[model samples]
Target: MRVVQGTRPLVIFDCDGVLVDSEPLSVQVLVDALNRRGVEIDEEEAYARFLGRSLSTLAQILHDDFDHSIDAAFLEDLRHELYDRFRQELKPVPGIAGVLETLDSTICVASSSQPERIRLSLSLTGLLERFEPFIFSASMVENGKPAPDLFLHAARAMKTDPADCIVIEDSPAGIEAAQRAGMAVFAFTGGSHAGAPGYSERIAGLAPDVVFDAMPDLIHLVRQHMEGPDRHRSPRAS
Candidate 1:
């Protein structure tokens, strides 16, 4: 048997669930923040409605769900307060450190999270510096997840074509966005609604190239792909 060594593939990652284990804490923060404003919501509902959406979009969802108007400014302030309260509790997903340290690919974060929240989460997880200028937020685009604009922006910024980019996401919206962008996706089943009813089927229905039940499994798969024979092929040319 021969071992293959080649250039790494370009990887685009979702910040919240894929890199940081912040979904549960984020849901808690949202619940607390909304409750403080006299609105209440459950975690499952939050997961279903806002898991992979931008803060602005989430505000709209809350507005529609509660039949109460939540202005952009109010949502911004609430998000800031939520971060202040919950940032310290945020942590990286298991095996993330090792995966990041061992990755041979040029990895960038393309997330639906606002840039500040993304920064805060990565900083808390001690993974902020790894991405640097490559951190892309959905707020940059007119449309967020379930729309291909964010991923397209990321692929463009990285100078890699969509087909060459591999997206790692944990939400149906994120998976759909990647698919629409014509990128290969790997669904991460390690977030708030991972084992929920129809979760597996939903992921499969999206036609992801792979689905991972654990961060370690995802890490291993990335390593193997990077070490595979086609790793050296330029994504743009492929």
Candidate 2:
């Protein structure tokens, strides 16, 4: 059953690159882990292949492209190392804290990352309490990004019509997922890894409703999109 739209638009955020500047750390950890197994991948290639994807997707890609099978032991070790790196170095995306403090809409996190990782990322960055019980993960849904499942699940859980939600994302997969779910999406390019060659171009190809690199500009963009007209309305709305 479809839910009724709430008076306040629901703002869904992607955790890794959007809320916390953890993409670089995640890529480096993944690359290092793959190198230990003789994969010889670089951070750039890693980002191209794995950014915005879940661990299960990463395992599949490693198996298909490199003929390397990942076992439970390897995944456990990788998580330990990744979490350690995150603990030591992770920081919230620049200006994100300020945006959260001032943005008036109801917000939640819908991420491709596992639930534990999502909580840890937000908790570490001092942003968890703002959206703790509202956090939704790909693990809670059957499909991840580029699929509408996760985003739709979030809308249902939040009791908001998909058409009345806004997704803030930093990856093509995330933007596409939001569009597939019938939500307005804004592409955020302020993460540490945003400068990689061709990254911005790739995101532009997706044609998200808005693309901006400064986090402080986010609240204004959301307000404009909400107030300007009904053009942002989703086709999924009945």
Candidate 3:
């Protein structure tokens, strides 16, 4: 059943840039790995092509699209390297804990990253306790973001109707996926990549329900969405 407007909706957060400040580090590993193998792509290209996308698709691009036959072993190596870097460098997004502490809705993580990767980062950032066991990964389904599969899979797993789930994401692909799944999506534009020169324009083109740059503002925006013009029910205060 759709979560009625007045009721608190299920809140699904994307892990990389939303919950943890790990995108730059994640893409850094990819860029360095590819360059070491003489692929020659820079961080900008990596972020443009792979940020918010799936690792499996990235492997396909390396093999089929770029003619760089990356073996599964290489992918495993990268995964291990990423985990190490995440443990050392990952930080929770600023003020995210406050929002998590106060939100009244059921919360879970639905991400494009591997389940292991998701857990590692969240654990490092001290945010895993809130989302443990309910984590959903794109690999669980056939497709990831921009296909609606992952979000819909998460919705089913969380036992929440698509319409009643509000996805907080940080990528264009994530926003597109939530829309395709018929959920309201709000984009987090406060990450390191969000400061890129053309990011604002790109996000505007996607046209999410709302764009927020600070983690503290998330609570207010979510409350406004839950308590619309008719004022069904105010979001619970912490």
Candidate 4:
């Protein structure tokens, strides 16, 4: 499903782990909130289960999978707390800004996080200007990751066919969604949460187009992918 036909390939970025190193911080908040209500989950469990998922998906999983339902009021408070923390402590994934500056492909962010959170995270890290009007949030579509809706919506809005796009993701849900949408995906493991138990194996098992552990390597990989037919062929084809 790796795309090789577009003149200007669209590269969709997943915000949290891929753009900003906020997963561990966000997961800590989520785990703390749930544990206060007796959910008894840990940070590693939270990341393994919900790393690239939206807040609604997390809420649904807590309810359907664990019988713990989260109300809107609670979620609102959690969002506020997350934003405040992000304002104080959030930082971009190391070396990502340089990659963004050097990448020649058309780019946009498609995140499970709210647009406001996305905006703030990028702004705090000084990455928002490059991606301002192009940020796509899960709230923009009927479904988030693990369903192809959000990514498909992004492809449509960007005027690119699914086959003409590639997603840079850091978790299984986003990789699965991109694949389902028929776009090639690259798993980025350079973020902080990647140190969690089973993180590398989890990504490896899903088999993204290629996995890279550094931002400079991503730039190199893209250069390779853009070299046309006999060059930059998808690994899946081989």
Highest lDDT against the true fold, candidate: 2
RMSD of each: 4.5, 3.0, 5.1, 3.1
In angstroms, the error of model 3 at 52 is 0.4
TM per candidate: 0.84, 0.94, 0.92, 0.92
Per-residue lDDT over 1-50 for candidate 2, one digit per residue giving the tens place of the 0 to 100 score = 12233346889999999999999999988889889999978988888888
**lDDT of each residue in 37-143, candidate 1, tens digit only:** 78877676777778788876887777777876776676777677678765556768888888887876789999998798889888888899999989999889999
lDDT scores for all predictions? 0.78, 0.87, 0.84, 0.86
Q: What is candidate 4's lDDT per residue for 120-147, written digit by digit as tens?
A: 9999999999897999999999888877
The whole-model C-alpha lDDT of candidate 4 against the native structure comes to 0.86
Local accuracy of candidate 3 as per-residue lDDT tens digits, 161-180: 78788899998788888888
In model 2, the clashing pairs are none
Give the CA lDDT, 0 to 100, for residue 58 in model 3: 80
Model 1 whole-model lDDT (C-alpha atoms): 0.78
Which run of 10 residues does model 3 get worst, by summed lDDT?
229-238
Q: Cα deviation in Å at residue 181, candidate 3?
A: 0.5
Comparing 1 with 2 on lDDT, the higher-scoring candidate is 2
Global CA lDDT of candidate 2, please? 0.87
Worst 10 residues of 4 by lDDT: 229-238
Error of 2 at 45 (Å): 1.3
lDDT of 1 at 132: 90
TM-score between model 4 and native: 0.92
